[model samples]
Target chain A: MSHIRIDNLTKVYMGRRSRPRNIHDPEEHFGDNILVLNDITLGFEEGEMVCILGPSGCGKSTLLRIIAGFEPPTNGTVRVGGQVVSAPSDQSIFVFQQGGLFPWMTVYENVGLGLRHIRDAATKHERIQEYVEMVELEAFEDYYPHQLSGGMQRRVELARALAVNPDLLIMDEPFSGLDFLTHMKMREEVVNMHEFLRKTTLVVTHDIDDALIMGDRIVVLSGRPSAVKLMHALNFPRPRDFEKNPGLSRLRSEIFLMLGVPYAV
Target chain B: MKQHNDGEPTMKDNPEQAPDSGNRSLRLGLLSLLVIILLWEVLARGTGWSVHIFPDPLTVVFSFVELLRDGTLLRHTVASLFRVTAGFYLAVCLGVPIGIVLGRSVNARSLFNPIIQFLRPISPLAWIPLAMLWFGIGDPPAIFLIFLASFFPMVVSTTIAVQNINPTYFQVAANFRFSYQETLTRLILPAIIPDVVTALRMTVTIAWLVVVAAEMIAVQSGLGYLILDARNALRMDYVMNGMIVIGVIGLLLDNIMKRLGDVESSKWGIQAR
Candidate 1:
């Protein structure tokens, strides 16, 4: 049995107001209804780092949101460890794209949110400090989210999420608004953290190279009324380099072609 | 020459210039006040208008001293302060929580918003007759009028503030398993503090405005009564004294309320606005 199983997931947004106008397929639009995801079945193994890639606005986030239990699927079910996922729980934490850290709370307080259940003060403080240090933000424990840079804010959010020791960590377009260098650094940090923790991590991204470099298994999703386009396990060793490795280079070109891009380079 | 002037003060000199600019503004403000007093003195003495109708600044200052010496000013000011405090506190206690409820729950907003909107436009002064009839002329009636003046604005502003809070924070709160009480205390309250402070500042001003009006009709021992009493006695200087005191106190209240938005936890909300 998989650690997380998304079985035959189908999400159709109903009602006039609920229907999004960003539908790529006009054929799928019925009156006051639009289909988002269609019969998508996938499973994530325990401690597996899965990167989901798709075209922009291709319902990748909807799928991730469903898995994290932020939104319900119109049909089909998402189960985690034999339990059906229904509502957002501390067992699975979702890190938003950006600016999710409470503006009013300092980094220490934000990270301590998960540890709020612990009655012992010293233990809670220790847990907060441990996660803060994990993200290399020990010097900024007292700083508020708005005081930090974009990358540092993301780090604080990451620390806040990881502090809970959730069984599954889901990130949606985590590096979208960051600068080039900051984005690469954050990507490296996430990969390193996943390597150390080996938690069931699902990352939704648009960058193919990011999926190739970070994912233990990479799943590509197609456009609206999305279904699984490809799911391949990347057994390529760590420090994967497309330039140095011919196989990775070939796979990158294949994925680019699969996504309808003419050439990789 | 301009380049040389700029070159003299590099980054090292910028900090020194900040306080210099502040001191300059303070001096200019005082000078402006002096000019206004001078203009008023010239107009009062040269216009040949009845001194009874428009007393000179010197005469008003003398009356101000007399009122202070007799403690009449203190007593009246205290009385007015008491009514405003009682009514404003009552409104805040009830209005803020109701506002949060309306902001959070669609059902509560739907049920209450129309009634609030209908009542909000009707002036607090319009309630003067009803308030006198109900509470019958004293601190109760005056305070009731002030409460009416401040309550609707407090509720409306707070509701807007809470509704404007980022929906992402609620999602974060749920993801962390924040209990209902924790959500209110840790999320809702802090998120709205800066806005609440601003609402409070404006509402307190309205309450102060109504306090004087309410006192002119309903009560006997406030600054408003002092002005009315002075008017009947044909002592224009005393009336001017009452106006000065009210203006000073209003300024002080505004400054204090402004400081609330500067507090560390609330500053984020202020800056976002």
Candidate 2:
């Protein structure tokens, strides 16, 4: 069964006028109305890891936000677990690009923030510790976000989301800021977590390699007023090692070709 | 690699070269104070001004000691401190929650903003007559004046702080399925603590100013009253002495509030400096 469904999503951004005229006409001063997402329709199956890939301003993040219920669509419906999403729901957690850990909170506290709503203290503690240990962040639990490196902060954010045990995890370019080595290490950690948790996930990224490495299925989105260009179901097996995986390079080239960007060896 | 217990890098591996930075700041501060005092002493001795008009720092210190010996200074200081504390606490208790509500709710803010703006421009001293008329020249009137002085700024600053918080924090709270009250208590309150602390420090200073001004008009037993009495008697030395006392006490109270704010902010890792 499909765990998440997005149908006919449309978002139009109305721009304001630069100057006011003596006669007021509502449409005259509406400088330029740009459509960001045009009738985007897609679905993800239960326990599947899906990546939405496109260039910047391709509305990939906008579509993810719609699915997360962070933003309302101009026209469409988003269903999670067979229920319509009107606003941000507890069933899905969205991880942002910049590792949005609250700077004021210690890492343990940051990870535990979502669990504060859980009335059962024992369960909250167990859940927090479980995810913290999963992310290998148990030692840095007391450190503040400012004290952590970008990669570590992202790990904390991931742990925070996982601790909530949501039905779906949504990530928007979660590893774009990290150095190459750190990004690779984080990818491995995420893959490991996904395999263990088996929770449905949707990730949006511009990096084709990341799409190939992390996604179970890749959905390429076309530029502004976006729509899905292609959806490829990867046949890579579990515990797949990136260094040893031959299909990654082939898939990367295919994605590059689909995106109409020059393919690099 | 020098690592923290958390396996992160630490600054301890390479010793900081400017190890004497703390000592340097302390020495410079003390030197500045000494220079100011020396200049004051020279002006007092060299000018044709009467010692009564502008007493040397030493004379002021001597008079301070004499007042201390007589216990009048302590009594007045305590009385002023008590008034300021009572008024400030009342303002905070009433102001912060009202501010938070106003900040969070647009209707509440719109309703109260006009009245607050109307009242804010009126000086604390201007409230003296009404306070006297309402409470009849006692501690109540004095405290009321101070409350009028401190409440608006505290409430305004707090409201602004709560309103201006990063929307991302609110989104996070909502994503976590927090109840509205839970969002306010757990996320919003903690996020605004730094701003609240800053406003609180400002409130204390304003309260100090208001209490002194209130004492001059509404009370017969505070530091301000001592200054008024000295002036009435034409004892300029005692007047200078009372002014000095007010200055020193105000500085001490401000320092204490600042240190308390520092401690509170540090716990949240949001310390200003």
Candidate 3:
């Protein structure tokens, strides 16, 4: 059995009122209910980094949320290590797309949240320090989320999630709001972290390059009422570069074509 | 030169420029106070009425010293402060928990929201007759009136604050397996502190306003009673002295609440600093 299995997952959001017909999604609405996910069946192997890529509003995050047990699937089941997922738990920690570090808490306090169950104060402090150091945020342990820059806040969140030592790590567009340099750096850090920890990590991203470089395997999802369009394994070695690898370059362009974006560059 | 100074400071320079502008405003504020006092003195003298009817600022000052010397001013001020503190604490203790419940539970909100709204706007002054009937003429009725005046705003503001908390924070709390108690203390309470402090600041003012009125009706020791008793004696200067004390105390209460807002953790998500 796979480490995590999402079988025939479907989500239907009950709308409050009738929405105007979306020209692109003509078949979406049926009596004030919008079909969001249509039969999303996927599996994750232990120690594999899977990147879910899709167009905006494709319900990729919704799928991630379901897998994390933050929301229930309208149909089908997500089983983790042979147990059915019913609610959010420490076994699967989700790093939110937006800044989720508690605004009121210092970085040390936020990271300490994962270790709150530990009875030994010294042990909890040590673990928090370890995670903070892993994120290279030891100097900012006393800083609040709002006091940090966008990239630093993401690091705090990453530290907080990693401090949980979860079996499954799920991130929803974790580096979405970062600047270009910070985005590249965070991508490298996430890939390195995955390599080091070998946790079953799943990330949702809009950037194709991010998927190609960081994912051990990439799952492409189609637009509204989204279904998995393509699933490809990268098997490429670390420090993957489109310039040096013809296969990676071809795959990158292919993704752009599949997403209906011209590979003009 | 003035235009140059005002226009040259860029966004990056705002921190450095803050103190200069703050100093200028303070000077302007003092100038405005002086002008207002001068206008009041002119009006007092021009009225040609006896000091009992329209006392000049000097007579009011003298009466302030006399009231101070006799200790009535201090006694009345302390009385008023005690009532405000008692009533304010009572409202906070009851209102915040109720607000949290209303905010978190849709059922509770639907059940109690309408009743709260209906009671909220009925002036505490209007409740004086009922309060006196229930508690009799003493501190209880006056305190009850202050509680009524402040409670609704506290509940409403706290409820809104809790509701306004980023849903993401609760999800984060859940992901980390935060227990019910931890969620309340660590997540819900701290998240609401900034807004609650602001609500307290506003509610305390409302409470202060009601205490005076409450004292006028149900009690005879607060600044409001002092004002009423002075009016009976036809002592306009004493009335002005009571007004001045009330205003100064009100200003002090607001400043203290503002300091609560400036606490490091509570300033989060509320302001840049």
| Candidate topping lDDT | 1
Clashing pairs in 2: none
Better of 2 and 3 by TM-score: 3
Q: Is candidate 1 or candidate 2 better by lDDT?
A: 1
Q: Which parts of model 3 have CA positions greater than 4 angstroms off?
A: A17-25, B1-27, B269-273
Native contacts recovered by model 2:
0.49
Candidate 2 TM-score, true structure as reference: 0.86
Expressed as tens digits, the lDDT of each residue in A1-265 for candidate 1 is: 9999989999988866645556664747755687899999998899999999999888999998898888999999999887999999998999999879998888899999889889999999989999999999988888878878999999999999999999999999899999999999999999999999999999999999999999999999998889999999999999889888898889889899888897877
- RMSD after Cα superposition, model 3: 4.0
Every candidate's fraction of true contacts kept comes to 0.67, 0.49, 0.77
For residues B192-269, could you state the per-residue lDDT of candidate 3 as single tens digits? Answer: 998899999999999999999999988879899999999999999999999999988898999999999988768764
Candidate 3 CAPRI level? medium
Window of ten residues with lowest summed lDDT in model 1 chain B? B3-12
lDDT of 3 by residue, A82-136 (tens): 8899999999999999868898888899999888789999988899999999999
Candidate 1, after superposition: displacement of residue B113 in Å?
Answer: 0.4
Q: Estimate every model's Cα lDDT from 0 to 1.
A: 0.91, 0.82, 0.90
Instruction: Show the lowest summed lDDT stretch of 10 residues, model 3 chain B.
Output: B3-12
User: What is the lDDT, from 0 to 100, of the residue A95 in candidate 2?
Assistant: 91
Question: Which residues of candidate 2, in runs, are more than 4 Å off?
Answer: A14-33, A117-123, A237-251, A257-260, A263-265, B1-27, B264-267, B270-273
